[model samples]
Target: MLFPVLALIPATRTEPSSLLKLLAGEFAAQVAATWPEPHAAFLAAPAARRHLTCLALALGRDLPPIAERLLGGRLRHAIRLVLDPAPSGLERLLGRLGELAWDAEDYRTLLRLLAQRAPAKVLRHAQQVEPGAVRRLAGLPEPMGEAVGLALELTAEGVLVLREAYDALRLRDGPEAADVAASGWARAGSGKALFEAVRDDLTPEPLAPPHAGTTHLRPLRSKAELREAARRYRNCLGDRLSDAATGWQAFYEWEGPPGAIIGIQRDPIFGWRLEEARVGGNGAVPEAAREAIVSELALMGVHVGRSGWRLERLLRDDVGRGYRYWPPSQDVAEAFGDED
Candidate 1:
């Protein structure tokens, strides 16, 4: 019964009256709803309900009883910021944090990060990672703050992967974490560069669903493996370890003379598409090797870019790549014939 309209004004503290009105409406609706047993546990708990307001109650209902015990009187301010406005782009994250091991002080740090307006990606990832890990980084006022303030320099690609990679680097390099953090935050530093610099040293997380690699196309499973491949190919494959680490892109090396690397990335539109096939030192991929690579990848249900158009009479399938009206290449065969 709450928020019959999907899009309402965002509940920022811009105007006291407007925020209060919205709060009142939400409260009335929620109070009227029937929450039984554990869902209404907060309402029945020893803690006062003064701080739980607006959509927070909706989030509150889903929290496991342990959260109720740990966060006695009030939900953290950061939790409030993330829970309100209904479509915070973080509703999914809220649902998954029912098991958060809350410390009053830790919650305060989270609040500080939000009040200072950390990037949405950073906040989202913070919620996803271990709270203790966040506490560690939050304590590093020098580099992480520099990392946060100079976001434009480092770019989101670097910050997006910061927490996970930071944790990994801490585990692997230990005392060197400070230097590593500086590498990302110094005026000359960047997130991408930081990742590239320590890609081999950083540990690799297990790929979800665990891909079984072929003899010729073994998936890049470790950062050490990435370093070896990058050296052999003389390509920037090392820079793409984050992509492979996340399983968004799977990097596989061809075991042979004139060695090659194939990048298969998951595409929302096309399941899995062959994004790259590069030879050693970024040389042009030979047609014979290209054919063999494509053939083997196809057997694994992976397709190349816009790759599924059936070969028609007298049309070479490999030469064309584009949508109906767009041109994938300047080749005459692609312009006049089906390319996608």
Candidate 2:
């Protein structure tokens, strides 16, 4: 039992060296208080390894019970988060894990440990939160994984935009992509405006002018923050009321007859990029409504991008039943089947 736990900790205090040790030692002290002198004596044998091993054994025997006590029954849920294949919650969840310690170094160590132990999960998580992280993590040789991991902990949001840039470069120029990307990442600094330089470098361009309303870039902090921004946008609309729902990638809400659509995506430099509100109707958007939408976003401090807002229509389904939200490449034949 102790060997497994011991094996996980680095002898040189590298990677998750600090966090794993701290958690192990703290857990040992807690269990030692409850056990009899003999069973718990190993916990205080005046040597780090002995104590860690003793504690690991005790916790292994009663993991669920101990986890419940430590995490208020949320330990199972947290562990489940670790097992999840999706990359979206890795950084946030890992941070939540070490939040009990409230030390930046501890949080970073835990992050490094998780990535080392579960590279795939870490890769996805970093990709979801900050593509630069995935690029940085991927390009690194084994030794630098931990060091870069620490850097990511500090600039998680700043690196989100790097994913697309890195991916584009990778597609064009395979393994050698890391050299150029890493240089950009090194100069990324605090991540603000980090993507401004690479936005054009992307094969297709991230800030391409939209055919619809003007594209404005608003860097919101979180999904919740985007919703709040949408709410403020509604307030700016004055009396117009429409049903609204916010999703991970975009915010869709009905406002009056024409309705409105705001697209959202992750950006490491600015956090989240929100498109300027667009008229969501089949017909031309009324000038009044367009002004109202643009005005509200501007007042809220969202930066207008390269293009100005314009009235444009989205493609609709045949028979005009509703807007066709799916991409053009979608296989409609497979979707509806040969039965029709």
> How would you encode candidate 1's per-residue C-alpha lDDT over 1-340 as one tens digit per residue?
5676645644332222332333233343333233222234334332223233323443445433334432353344334443443334343334333332244455445445554444435656543543454454465433455344344444334455655565666666674774555454444365455555444446355264234656677777777777788987798887887787777887777664557887777766567767677777766666566666767777777765453332232154444454233333322222112233
Query: Candidate 2: which stretches are off by over 4 Å?
Result: 1-39, 45-165, 198-200, 203-340
TM-score of 1: 0.37
TM-score of each: 0.37, 0.25
lDDT of 2 by residue, 172-252 (tens): 776466446545555544444345445423423123222223334333333344345446545332111111122223343
After superposition on all C-alphas, the RMSD of every candidate to the true structure, in Å, is 17.6, 20.4
> Candidate 1 — worst ten consecutive residues by lDDT sum?
330-339
Local lDDT at 30 for model 1: 39
- Where does the lowest 10-residue lDDT sum fall in candidate 2? 237-246
